[model samples]
Target: MPDTETPAPQLLELARSLGVATEYWDWQGEHVTVPEGTVRAVLEALGVDVSTPEAVRLSAVELDERPWRRVLPPSVVVRQGARTAVPVHLPHGTSVAAWIELEDGGRRELVQQERWVEPRVVDGGQVGEASFELPADLPLGWHRLRARVGDAEPAVAALVVTPDRLTLPASVAGRRAWGVMTQLYQVRSRRSWGVGDLADLAELASWTGGDLGADFVLVNPLHAAEPVAPMEPSPYLPTTRRFVNPLYIRVEAIDEVAYMPAAQRQLLEWQAEAVQATNGDDTIDRDGAWAAKRSALETVFRLPRSPGRQIAFERYCVEQGEGLVDFATWCALAEEHGPAWTQWPEQLHDPRSAAVAEERERLADTVELHRWMQWVVDEQLATAHRRAREAGMRLGVVHDLAVGVHPEGADVWGLGPALARGVTVGAPPDPFNQQGQDWSQPPWRPDQLAELGYAPYRDMLRTVLRHAGGIRIDHVIGLFRLWWVPAGQPPTEGTYVRYDHEALVGILALEAQRSGALVVGEDLGVVEPWVRTYLEERGVLGTSILWFERQEGGVPLRPEAWRELCLASVTTHDLPPSAGYLAGEHVDLRARLELLTRPVEQERALDEADRAQVLDAVRARGLLREGAGEQEVVEALHRYLTWAPSRLLGVALADMVGDHRTVNQPGTDEEYPNWRVPLADGSGTVLLLEDVVRSRRARSLARAVRTR
Candidate 1:
């Protein structure tokens, strides 16, 4: 156990300087102090040495002195169309020269805006601070700042210029648009091999956008998972945010498959058919589907690429550069050793070791195969986006970006030292999750991120936004702060860590602006009030769930009272679909799984009261009729959502088919089939894409929102 005794002031100051919270208020409204040992451990993971009082004092002094020592700070982010002053540190009375290099190879001179301040003693020398003014009209992109002081080496720092706000595209600005939200893997069609793929996504978009007059289709994260069997089912925990999972690829959709020899193609077709046999099963067989798909993909990879195809592939390789190589190499290594890189031989653990280089050479073929798989997925994603646009969707495909990457995954391994060690990202205990929740994904060290100019984060956003018309950032509060839970500690013992929201959010807005895409932040559950206001001020839409919109007396807030800058929905994946929620299936499932925090009877009573309030609200609006069944109530709820002033409204696909199962339960993993549940009706009948399009329930729900 960590020592809870009084901590030295210097220790607390050092921790604060490193962005670790020394104390925080818990959900119970009580002040809780972080253990001294926990703080030290977290600091160490952040690469700060605070093992003793002397070390803490020394670290504190270094923190104050380091910024002054550097000719220019490691990185600086300024909002576009705003003139900002950047500080420059130099020896006392020394003259400095500085210039800005734009992203397009253009250069501009910066003017020193302020006179030098009085010199201060630092490490036996006097240092002076002065301010330089940056032009207000600098283009939005990553730029460079070069500075020189006296006879010293030229110092260069990254200067990221970003937009002040993310604005909606003209195509979607003046209209109230409705869309469908779905877990793509669970929405398998008759043509899919057990698991839904990009091809199905395109088809669904075409049906909804073209036939139903929907404007967008929002799907769960398609981020990459481990390349091997026993794949991680949760899309929120990914191996790499920069790449898409090849498991979601359609085998027959690749152009090269058409040119393959007859025998090989027949074998692949047989495998696909056999895999498709599981489509009607209650749960998806991810491992089986992946194995069969992998075999077919292996065959497809053997077909020689045509000249034009080869040129495109090579261009992609060059564009991706070292990042792709590192990720592909990690995949190949996982194939040989296993998914957990920590359990591998010591020499192979370090990505830059000579042994890894030799191993990369030995496994060059496997690495290339992994790279080929990425290219295939990228092509399919582009096709899906194109299809949505062709079908007249405004914000065609709104992709989800998961919060963080898995601990033993590609990003952590490849971007070694950039990610903090021995800590996980999670949430504090709340009413919904009494024990709090810990997601075993490592977070990026704030210091390291700034040191590297947030390149990894930039690369990830750029990649995901490449073919997306909009993006939903899951747990978007993470941009401002994240709960850093020490390894081997309960989530209740975690502390909040602050991030540079200005830089982070500014970069996000810049990227969205450049991509001409909309940004919707999932700002639900225990978020600071200021964060939402900030996001709204920046034109980033927030997420609003119908059940949680309430006033002080627990009365459901009226539809018209809800925030206009939101994507309103009746339910989320974390809860049961509207049909099941109305039936109290969530309570029953929790009871069965031993997840109830109170007695089942009491819990059900409270749930009933909550349901009554929601129904009463709908009844008052005349949207619900007397003795309405779950289907009618579901439509009524959606109709209520349409009444809100929100620009974008979402209708879950599961609700359209009256699926009774929840896509995920917050605190439990193996206790329930979280992400594996197929889209099913109230009677537990599996519903495929074809059934969804033809179902009267789906069309009725669509009509409710469209007519509203």
Candidate 2:
């Protein structure tokens, strides 16, 4: 209909050049061809113009020639001890000299390699390519390459040397460590403002690591959400992964709060009491809590900062530089123009527009307020990390990194052009989610990322790993490739867009190595086998959920069969805890939501059979006795994990207390509460953090995996 000048074969070739997979093997082992329209839409989202045959040809030629047009690549990420050649483009007959400037202020001259190739004309000037070989003895850090071509100014590009394979910390070296995992928002304490805050996390980590003799306490992502009320409930869909959510900031924990006026303190006390009253409520109230907390925080924010505090805040602002200002400016603007920048006035849509610049000056105070909020969060997070390590935890707090940021949130608004516009990141059809999923979070344009030296991606990783001893990448497979669902299209119509894993994963490991932290990738759904091996080679652990770890004929995979480089767990957040899973709660939940492709009874029967096989395996391994109760089966399942040689064993807090509810139900938005479910025990009675610490059931489960 649209001039079909871009023929099917030509379109496929162009898509292939852009790393869009035209055909891929699904989870069902069937080859599925991606729709032509899907390819066109995906390409357009990548800023490729395929409207006309001439345009398509130009795009392809540009793709091949763009590198020749540059003096040096935007960035170069290479592993230590690996000799990689950097291509330096210059005017055909011009002479050049290149050298690497190490992060430690050292310099190394790069040796020129003989590269014989015909000169090509780019932009009416003949360009020649020269190869500079990187030394194998380069140190790991953020370095730069400087190339002086002819009489022009020297060209500079980012040159990063990442670790070849990250090694485990000495604290966790040679020993299998176990940890407790939970969604922190659901584990509210009486002291919190109707939700779990950083103070509560410190308490949870202190108790679990010191008392329970655990190595670490893993929690859900603390990524920022909208400042206003009616917040997005799912932590996985956040405003920005670069900053912490102010909602999780404990007001009383702020130092300035203690220095506030007496009358203001009294009013804050009353506000805390009002919000804490909702702690026992079945559903977690994010809107009410943030609305009240943000006001209380604002009062403390207004109090004059101590001289030392002021210096620290200013230093943070200077270190964060333009990115922080842009984010804060976007936040202030959102307060007036609304959260979605796309819906703002046309002139304000571009973050760099003159109108937005003027608006930033007009909203300077609000912008500073937002920046101050982040500084507070950073201090609180650091305190939590310090407490965890002091309590004898090997890895301290391991934070979860969500897959992507919200579509209309700060990242999309602040990051301008780095993220795709017309496509969203999602999942392909898998056994767990039959119809697939559209997460409504935009994917990064691979080309743009490489062009920008991956600054945004690196900034995100550096921030998340800043206070963490370890970080789990949600949907880690996304680093290699992501399913790109076109605008207004279902996930089934999407295609796989490949990413440069060699560079992406190398940068990830590089950041973790620099931070002295471990990396765990949630490589659970529809992952290619080679991808798992590649991750392991980089010393990044894979995630293994017991239910999904199956062997031949879909039977249970023996404990010894699980990979050692994995974080093995009996249950995950998406599914019910071990207790509820044993009772077939997941099947009943799907049936109720009408998410089943088969009859409810038939689905229940199949689930029962699967459960029986796993339980039987547990019994055969002598972890459970014959005719054991639900509690024994749950504990035994975890005890079953201990038999596996996985480096890290993850015990869910819900499974420990025999909580029967699922924290999230996939494929349903309004039909289920998803991430809003509070922590509860076996009888469906909600429990506070204080209640959980002294529970006998929890202690019993803790003992199950504490030793071998």
Candidate 3:
């Protein structure tokens, strides 16, 4: 923990110093008086020099007590070509400001700014209403209306200004809703030797949509990772969120592959064999995988760039100019300076300095190489999405947008001031992770992001949604509140920092609306209950993990009570596969690495009981027969998960393949093998595509998808 004793005061001071609202403050109970000296002391502790009256004046703008989510409501509708009236409910003692802006550069400019809309003095829950009017002179295109109340983030929605207010698409407004969340590289593929590539994704669409009746296939983040050894295994910490990872591209699936030279085609086959051999077990080597793909792409790059490929590349470059250039520059810097740019020479390190541009020009080939790779990734992903749509899928491809980027990544380098320099994003201590977890990624500067009109965020969303029908925002609470650990502080010693949640959700809604994409928030752990309600109201889905789907206030919720606004799952990548959890493989895996906090015997004893109880409960629920075998247990669990009320469901690839280990473990990095775990059969040989498809468990899962 930091030397500073009072975190709340210091946190409030920090927010005040930054001219942002603080979510909480220290006030003597019912006093209506706060110590000015206490506030000053807090400011000093956070390293703010606030002696002057101007500083005090700024800080005096009463610290905001409400959470960001409370301030921001979800969506609203408006009529076209008329001054429309709409009444919206607000929280107790809330203040609302209403305004509208047309697509054609016209603004209504907070016309009825900051009107206090107090709730009626009722005995039950608080609720009140405020009325706002829309602009009459709006164009036929989409318009936006915004209303803000208190510390709540503003509520925003796009108004379809048309002659007729027709109902929205069935995928958006009706019952045909479901999206798949896949780890693209980890999918059980047929064509490509081992890892799932764009071709496999295309195949999955045919299988899921045609055979299993899935609406969408949501994949894990396919964003580009830093292309070097000891690569970060987690897709969330990508080198560039704006670009796709080329490692996911199938060289053999390229349209111009037939025209490749004989030597190159043979090399491709050889590389494919090597890839298969490399991932022949229940582990994946991302570095090795990327190296093999890079070698093959180099061969392809050596040949003439196809006209169609060149045109697509040009279009992408135009769409992503500065971001792409900056990302390529960061990639080049990583090559020379290593992953951490802070270790580089001062002149070459600064992202905006002319020296960096000079360095980029000097290493032009490397930069363009990164660009070419992204273009290919984009093309293949787009093709996969097209295939899913053609297969009659409701929601084509759902992509994952990680909460943050690697601190030494393109996003941080490009949006320098938009990220806090000495802070890291992490979670507070919870039951699962007692000491808490620091993700080692930088959180966006809320004020700076808002000031820049959220361009970086908007662009990142636009890029990720390019070929996605839906997106799962991992750790979605970061949009409203992020647990920020100051540099050199332990993970537990962090403050709940707030953001412009209304603007964030508004931007999300706007983008999702424009792209015709659904939004899902991974809103688990320590989240305020209302966050789910807010997300649901905005058409954003929530994640419902089986382990955490308990009734509020510590009671275990019945499976049937699971909310419809969730993507229910038996296990997540961070946790063990269902079979592994049932068999106590997690305890064994942890024990192997000396990661167990308790004594080995004690841990094993606990695991035995937990495992037995879960199995017994399942059997009692008629999911399993008494004394069922391990295979029987697996089948029963699948049936139980399918019965969940969540509209969308995810079956982890590891579970599907019966792999005991997880793709990632929270704490230990090298202490245990982390992300190298592959999808394999029980015999330990790489489960070939044919073998996986033929498995009993796979058949059962397929049946669940087709029937339920």
Candidate 4:
């Protein structure tokens, strides 16, 4: 199904105009031309008419005339202190006046600049372009630029002036901040429902900050999954990234639970008892746990709310506006007709249709329940942040932002045209993953985002950052470009689609500055070198792992050589803990999952050499002895992290407890227990949050990372 034939010149030109790459160098340093079929398919997903040559020419004509058709450009994003020139198009000899409405209700008139470009005929009329100088002193906030030509209604577009670089929060302004990185679902406490909950998060943050002197607790993305059984286990493959998962709710902690009648209390207690019994299992049982918890949540939802609580809930609903309503509507619809909107009745497929509106009114009660759940999640998360801060945590909870949403999820159903259809986001072939990867999540269409002024992206950021002190953007490179793998095609057949990074990243910086939250971009894998520099310049930190930080000759890079603006860690969630890595558990696990490209022994030997080289560096740096024990070596690895000048240090909770099991493996889906591994040590003993706090090994590793 992949057409390797080169595209015609006109097709190539149109592709380039649409930000599609015709050719790119792979991670293996080989020039690979993107399949022509892939390019055409991606264009089709972006709403281009590419069914025939005639259609292609018509699409190209539309693209060429797009700017001329606009009175003002869709949006203008500029850094504070930088003057920008924006173009305005109008019919020949038509006079216009343009001005900027500042965020604080202030106004500034735009100065027109003369340009000599020839007019072009668009839609049977010759259109001329004029340039306007946007002032350098424009304040940093979301503003509006307005223009009126020939006494017509004023044309307007968004005007955003973002900070050149984000300002660091007080806690991390002048010193390094170290904290625990963990999968919150696997971090069950004694009091949580089978899986970890917000209550567990608060307790962990409080203990880590109060006793361990940690600054923040970085957890996996707690994004919402399906509202029914067989829910997705991987947090990264969530239904929506903008909202919190209701699965993490602590049923007993809800205020209404305390006020329930005796019969209701007995019923909820039964549900809680059923779910809590699975807490000590070897693997996380999300479906079974969610079933019990969902029933309990339904019981809680039925309880009456006090007038004050009702007012707060209503206020939250009003503040969230339409996005919240639509998300809740999706949830109710999913419960009735299943999560996949594609399989729903054809009339209901269009979320904005009259059919959906009628359905929304019919399911208003269920929609209200979902909305209330989000409000409860907000309250509980706010409580966690408060507890962390009260315990002296500098940054408190640093949430994760997953790259994209599920194909049939809420965002895909709601964000309609903003995201491209029929293509999924993934990676091109690389040495590590020879077959490449297909993450079945639709990517945002850059052109549509500009047309819509990026409202969906901005709103998602605001919601996530509301209760978080920081956000780790998974695959932040996606803000610049993404690999678009067309449906029914392998990932290797995909091509890159460039986004307007200057606009996307600038908005992120603006949002982070407003929230007073730190931004860390996961800059791993094959990245364009300047992307890292750009992110750093925007006050976004980068991620650095111990094993991946190697020189061209394959020697371990010294900690001193690491970037100052990074989160340096010995191991991440994808790999086993430091102890397991030393023992080659990742290689063996890969072998078991059949993910290895070579023989197990060969992979194991290569892995050993890599580990030995790192340990040798650790010894040379005076952090370890010639014959250190496993625990000592693990602690020394963390000590190696402390040697880096990086502003942030992350010590995995798994490593603190000598966990040999990895929570996730990159290449394996169902073959490996990815995202299901409970918090455990080398002997396969499941450990609780409290168990981690009391462990001597955990305490020693914490001290090692804390050492300056």
Candidate 5:
């Protein structure tokens, strides 16, 4: 049991000042108090010392003095067309001047706004707080602000100007569109080397858009993973979100590989043949496929590059700049000292250390190889997007962005203290997941993020949207706040930590607008009511899964009553595919894995009740007839989603061929083959891309969705 003693007032105040919540309402509608220990742990993660009353008091004083001590805040984010004020603190009666340096090298004078508050004495000196108003017509880009107090050194801070709101692209404006969502790695084709690659994705997009008249093809995150075997399989827990995984690169698609010497080409062909043998297996062997692919890629990597190719590779390296170098360096170092940076030598732990710099030079060739791998994947990803456009996809490919990266992965190794330590990002106990979930990934320190001007966040968004027509942010609620679980503690013992949603969302919209991409937030579970409205106000679509759309008393909401600004779907990747869900396969699997919190019989009874309600709803909506089977119910559910006024509708590919197996079972890892199951048909037979394109059942489901 947690301590029930009242927390010290100073401790609570310090926690609040650091954005840590002392209490939050749980799913059961009970006001659960966060233990003082939990609060202190979270504060310490944020670099605050609150171990004792004196420490808490000192921390609170520092928090209060921070803004006044600095000439300006670390960074200021303002929406375009809004006259924003920047606060400046200086000695009483000191004259101040401020100016803005535009992103394009232009300068503009800012006017000092009127003072609205009285001065206060701090640290034996009176400090007056003043405001300066930025030009309302400032352009949308990153700018700089320079503030000068009379005869004092000028202080500079980052200024980010964002668009008021993101708007839909011309192709999708005022139009209802539909798309197909799939686990890209599971959708194999004859040409792929075991796992589905960019070529396979392009082929699917082309066929669906050109033949089925679909507007987009949404796929799982293609984020980078470990370079060696024993790789992390879940796409949600990637090594780096900014770079594409080389595992998804179709080796033969590279032009240089096509022009390889005959002997090398033959060896590559043999390696490809060996990998392709796994294509028919029910489980995806990522390790086996990568081992073979890596060998072939090395052969190509060693070949002399043509003058044109050499110039292009150098250009890409230059464009990527220091970020690419840091990532590539981490990759090379990981290969030498193993994947976890913490286990490596202390001298190589810090990315900026002199030893690390010398290591980069010593392992220059290995670093270049990692860089080349990224370039290969980048080119193939671009080709896939181009193919989607050529095949008449309105919005083309919609990419998924995972919530966070692995704690011991490249991003953490490179990002350093920007990511919190000791505590992991997770969720408190919720209705569906009674035990709560610890994601095991570090959360970004809000203060550190602001101090760095949110460059890391912006960079991630830019990379994800590079070749995507749209992007889905998994666990989108995290943008506003994250539940922080202390190390060695259960997720239920976590507390909410608030972030500057204004700045985060503003920057998100700005990046989406600049990229001409649509944004969709996966706000399906436990989201605040205002968050949906907030996202809609910014033209970001919310996710509405069919089974979870309910009114008061748990009755399913009518399709017409669903939110218009949403991506309506019959099922999501997290849940069982529609077919298996209707048949209660998830219940049986959970029971077998011992993942059920309640008795099996009781859980089954509840699942049956839920299924019956959904069936009745479908019948009432005229989507299903009496005694409809699982296959019919699957079609009806998708058809029902089409009736929604949502701007975007998504059809899961698993439902098309009537695959009953779940793609992922959240609570279980090795007990269930998560992220390894290949796409299959109703009979549990693995289905290749060619088989899917020609399947009559797939065509039937596509027709039902398109008929609307």
Candidate 6:
């Protein structure tokens, strides 16, 4: 029995603080249109019951700290400025202990211990008796208390301890690590259907970490995108960021598929050849590869799941419960909305409406299918992570967390009210583009994220960390500020919106320490210099590209000056590969495309001289033979990167094979074949994974940096 009247202003404020840009929401209406699938995703994020008719409420309710579980690491809460007892709800027949862990100068010691009896509540709930104490002498920061019953057991009825306040210390050190970047999709493998998958990632990690003695391998985001016919090719513009794309799943490695009946096996095996066709020297056909795998998975899922498989699936379902439901709902809504939900039906419009619940129940099968896909993707991703670790990767499975999701995608749909509908995030006009660029994706409001305690951010981080040893935060400057273009406005009309830098860095540090994963920010633009210093103090690493690692006076900083914690790469997704850079293909392409802001001839002349100097520097470092040619000079540049003192180095998959093309171009989408090209060798043919590993180029590069 909840009130159905208009939500209070405070609620609206909460929504706004959480990045909600709308005062009211109607899912099916014109003003507040959201893809049906996106609505479901929002609902799922809030842990709403899809089958239930009641409109699920999304609120963070405060209550007396209660014991929610009775396992080890029992949750507890700390009161502000006082050592006190706050009664909390608990499950019946659960044992608990309460104690506070105090921190002083980086040392953690337990204090203020108290035990309590289980109390019976009149409202048919159990409560814990007595309160825990806090030290008056403790300095301010996040301190936690634990109510525990068992060691090494899942938490049962424990209260969640949250400190009332904290004062961050000033002298935080910059990270002392580094990583390399790679494009998995471009990292073609012998076994891959057409594009790279987790298997290829595992292989790269093994070589880079075990052989090259690198700390981490940074990479492009692998977030799930719209799985429609003729799928959107760009990895940056994903359908959903919370889930992995099923297209990247390694089907041949599935345990259930391996145990399938002979007839089923034969049917799946028949499709392997078609899937393997892309593994040859051909441009990647993403749609064809996914089509084959999707068909195969549907059949594999149909066969009765084994007990062990059932257990795993059930566990996955439980773990991904609300998130899965929402994604599925969005998938269905995307179908109903077609191109955009802004033009969808009125009655079924609002994400929090009863109409959505009804539609969700009516379209149960479709919703379930989306959930199944997520489960499979999660499973495969986890398997890949495990394999990378087992293969002796020093820091396995460094994942790429994209800067933002597509405007019409799941994240935007779920937080429509919070996200500004008319504003799209992008970069200001730079030397490269006279007319700035608009990414067409909504960005989170800084104030909104703070008020919400960064729950969405936290949840997304938790999810991504599941299959990663570290995470590369793409476009890291977004955490400090973002260039926002008002909807319908030109990119040039955009203004910079500032973010909560302190909170952003704080939460990031907290999450990183919690996950035991290193944080590398892609700080590669006209960023505020203090931003890097701040990130460093917080133990977060900055991205350092060799091409851009120059001092104030146009002098290149020595390798030792580069921070060890930062990731050093020769190029990025938007840049040309090593071969292309050395061969002057990028310069030629830009000149041909008229992308240069300066005179074409002048730009070309300057670029040629710059390229020559870079090659000369590589040769001087002994990275190349004295008389090395252009391609060999490119190899030498890579050798310089691999041997750099930086902790992590990302060798783009394209660079590993001497591929020249850029995987993605920022300004031009259709004008240039962005994200659609394959990783090719010299002579312009696609390079197969097996063939790549067997090639002289790969061997030469591998041998050059096989320090470990």
Task: Please report, in order, the local distance difference test score of every candidate based on alpha carbons.
Answer: 0.90, 0.90, 0.68, 0.90, 0.89, 0.63
Evaluated against the true structure, the overall lDDT of model 4 is 0.90
lDDT order of candidates, top first: 2, 1, 4, 5, 3, 6
What is candidate 3's lDDT per residue for 437-548, written digit by digit as tens? 7887877876557545567877898898888888889999888788776666666556566676656776777677677777778998778778877777666778987666
If both were scored by TM-score, which would come out higher, candidate 3 or candidate 5? 5
RMSD in angstroms, candidate 1? 1.4
TM-score of each: 0.98, 0.97, 0.80, 0.98, 0.98, 0.75
Stretches > 4 Å off in candidate 2 = 1-7, 123-125
Q: Residue 100 in model 6: shift from native, Å?
A: 11
Which is better, 1 or 6, measured by lDDT?
Answer: 1
What is candidate 5's lDDT per residue for 1-708, written digit by digit as tens? 654565688898878877789998887789988888798889999999877788888889888888888889999999899988899999989999999999999999888887676887788899998899888999999999999999999899999998888888889987898999999998899988999999999999999999989899999999999988788899998999999889998999888887888988888888898889899998999999988888878778988889999999999999888889999999899889888989999999999999999999999999999999988898899999999989999999999999889999999999888899999998876645667888898998999999998999999999899898999999888988899999998888889999998898899899988889999999976688998898888788999998788898888888899999889998999788888888788888878887677888998898888778877988887889998777787888888888789999998999888888898877666788899999999889999999999988888888888876
Q: Deviation in angstroms for 327 in model 6?
A: 0.8
- The reply for model 5, stretches above 4 Å from the true place, is 1-6
Candidate 1 has which clashing residue pairs, if any? none
Cα lDDT over the full model 5: 0.89
Model 6, position 462: C-alpha lDDT score:
73
What candidate 6 gets wrong by more than 4 Å, as runs, is: 1-180, 206-215, 336-339, 619-626, 642-644
Model 1 CA deviation exceeding 4 Å by range: 1-6
Q: Cα deviation of 65 in candidate 2 (Å)?
A: 1.9
